[model samples]
Target: MTASIIEHQDLGTGTEEPVATAAPDLARPLIPNPQSSIPLSTTPQDHHIARMAAVALGLTLIENAIPTPLPGVKPGLANIVTLIVLTRYGWRVAAWVSLLRVLAGSLLFGSFLTPGFFLSLAGAVCSLVVLAFAQHLPTRWFGAVSHSIYAAFAHITGQMLVVYLWLIPHAGITYLIPIFATAALIFGTVNGLIAARFMNSKNEMLIHENNERHEIG
Candidate 1:
């Protein structure tokens, strides 16, 4: 029967032709391939950016929940993650995380396409630009804390520009700069300290791991 089946498929050859069959695993049923099923391909970096963005988004939500005296003021706790990502990965990854957080947070909070959303986007863009320059500074002196302050100031500056140009469109808006600057300094320092501490801990853990590996070797 097998010979006859092969003979039937053998057209002009007049000889038995090999039959290709998919060997199905009895224990595992077939399903759509998770890898190729996607329309666009993704890389490890994409996933890493996504996870970091999620963390920032969570921080954003937490910051939103916290009551503040000022309307546009929050701790900016998410900046801590951005600083760390900048150091560990690079500017590109950090930018992705920061921008994604702004976009996703706005959508989540039902503020998409609103003035609030524009403010968030402006701040994020400014921070990312400042970080691009800040990253070029000497790492010895201008580390996480310095970068945090620069980015924070840039963030506020962007928001203020947006307010002056689009929203308020008056000289009176300039007066609020001092208030926003103060908030930036405070939050920047706090977030920077936290990020520095976190990075220090990670470095210590890596050193310990290397020592253990040397000992094992």
Candidate 2:
């Protein structure tokens, strides 16, 4: 007699349903994607502008922190970066950086849309306009030092105009020009020297790198 052969699955009751297999996990991890390889979309010029703006803003904050003997007697260190950008890049690039610094600095310092911000904006705009003309002057005769002094004067003039027109209308404010001029002269010279030194060093470094590449090739 032949033994009855039956499949294991066939032994199950007809009412029993087949078990479904679990699908593979397609969900991403909850951890942050710190290792993402995507690069920033900003170009080199954008990066340069951003870096300059940041440096200028930082200088602005530092100037704000320093105690001043007078209301408008800060060192204006931020102008150094602006001068550097103007000489190295151009008036347009410098303008962008300067305006960005004013806006970002005002926002960072919690002075946005205030009288202080208006003054800063006016000063920056005037300085940029002056620099646009100044940059066209002979580089040999009008260097960073000259540009700095001119821009400093322009800045102060712009601020004074804004103050006189909007903040405080007073003819006596013109008397303060000598003091502001003195401060601008001193600070502009110092800032110009610093910017010149930095630009010189940067140029040297670039030259060295280029020489190395040439020799390598």
Candidate 3:
């Protein structure tokens, strides 16, 4: 997602400060920090992270089950979890979940440490990097949809670079760019919309729970 930099006047300082305003609906408060009573060895946060990773792995497995007409053209269903975690938890959690998904998913598929694993790893790292920067942008201008598109293109770009440098050196490989780009665009937008719906649903649930608690009190 692209962010629009807003210039804010600092009356006290008599200077303009650039404010990055995320869309009110899209931007959420950070998850509350875990309690100090929780031991460092095993914490509630770890369980939450594990759950996120498990969901992502489940999605990866489902995608793996489907047969694709074109190679490397999967819908990337696993990324939905990454998007959700990134938006709700933070980049660190999102990165950990994504890397765990790639590692565990590759192992389950019996492609651990192989070219496929590396390819997946490369794409994930690239996508995470793009997301890291994109998250800083104004949410109104760069919400989940734009973030997905950005990550999609970054993933393809990273894989293509790897293919050219290590797997296939031939210039003919460049011909595949358009096909990959087209797929990325379609899948990215679809994934973003789905994630957005999920996010909204979750947000509503949270709001309802809070209201119920307030009324009970």
Best candidate per TM-score, number? 1
Cα TM-score of candidate 2: 0.73
**Candidate 3 lDDT (Cα, whole model)?**
0.82
Q: With candidate 1 superimposed using the best TM-score fit, by how many Å does residue 125's alpha carbon deviate from the native?
A: 0.4
lDDT per residue as tens, model 1, 4-59: 22332423221233444337555653334545543333334555677788999999
C-alpha lDDT score of every prediction, in listed order: 0.84, 0.79, 0.82
Give each model a TM-score: 0.78, 0.73, 0.75
The TM-score obtained by model 1 is: 0.78
Model 3, 1-217: lDDT tens per residue? 0112112212222123333344544354222333433323323355567778898999998898999999998899999989988888789989989999999999899999888889999999999999999989898777788888899999999899888999999999989999999999999999998888898987889999999999999
C-alpha RMSD in Å of predicted model 3 compared with the true structure: 14.5
Q: In candidate 2, what are the lDDT values of residues 124-178, reduced to their tens digit? A: 8988888889889998787888888888889898999999999889999889989
Answer with 2 or 3, whichever has the higher lDDT. Answer: 3
Positional deviation of 69 in candidate 1, in angstroms?
A: 0.6
- Return the clash pairs for model 2, or none: none
User: What is residue 94's positional error in candidate 2, in angstroms?
Assistant: 0.7
Query: Candidate 2: lDDT of 184?
Result: 85
